[model samples]
Target: MLLGDVAHLRTGDKGDISQISVIAYDPADFPLIAREVTVARVLRHLSGVAVRAATRHELPDLGALNFVLEGALNGGVTRSLALDAHGKALGAQLLDLPLDGDAES
Candidate 1:
């Protein structure tokens, strides 16, 4: 699932953090796919901002994982989201970043 869906997003202090409950596919599915989807959604919604790290956790009995997306925002500021005449964020300027290997999806 995308970070924009069913996730609580927080920005400030250290970085941008997103917490999501684990889905039905998480436990049996490949962790990479889930991580990739989560990361991509987070980065994309925030406009391709790189994350310092994302940690996943499985709750005791609830069977959910909380994902934390760190350092993906401009230190929680509005300046990075402002567009000059055009609709865009500063992170949008980095759209040309090349993707390598198997993470192209």
Candidate 2:
């Protein structure tokens, strides 16, 4: 599936509950980039962890993508992991995305 294809994901919140937020980003695909940082694919690549995900919207004008994820922090990776060590959560998520044109260098 294309990175932009993911729209929504469901995961634990507090007591088997989950929270969902629409991915946000700059018109320059900042949201897409941010979501990628937390994308399930990247998590799997880095530590073999799986995250739930879904696409929310595509801002073609700005060339950005928005996705919802489940239990983004279910793993200790969210708490015990350092930003540098775990990657900027968002950046780590985008590791496998095929973004083109005006990519945030």
Candidate 3:
């Protein structure tokens, strides 16, 4: 199964940094997301992009996982020549990450 099967994605950016927020549509799936969506896994999934580091922040109350990525904007909107310099597509890309466990039906 895929991460997107159980959760939704939202993205944000600042300078050379970016954020990917993975929120579970159902509260029951939060624990599964927390286990499968680790910093290492996210970094690996985003290996095609130039990112310095990744960190996972848990928002238990909100049932979400926020991953803050550093040096991932290709030098941000002002510097990057890429069409989508804001990295809006990154969240969609991350949705392809494989889910490691049986994350609900």
Candidate number achieving the greatest lDDT relative to the actual structure: 3
* Number of the predicted model whose TM-score against the real structure is largest: 3
Model 3 lDDT per residue over 12-99, tens place: 9989999999999998999999998888888878787888888889999999999999988998878898778575788988887888
Sort by lDDT, top down from the best: 3, 2, 1
TM-score of each: 0.38, 0.34, 0.90
- lDDT digits (tens) for residues 20-104 of candidate 1: 3434333433343344444454345445455677665555344344555565454444434622311123223323223222334
Candidate 3 — which residues are off by over 4 angstroms? 101-105
Candidate 3, position 67, lDDT: 90
Worst 10 residues of 1 by lDDT: 82-91
* TM-score of predicted structure 3: 0.90
For candidate 3, give the lDDT of residue 105. Answer: 21
Model 1 residue 27 CA deviation in Å: 9.4
Give the Cα error of residue 86 in candidate 3, in Å.
2.6
Instruction: Note the Cα lDDT for every prediction shown.
Output: 0.40, 0.40, 0.86
Displacement of residue 10 (Cα, Å) in model 3 is 1.4
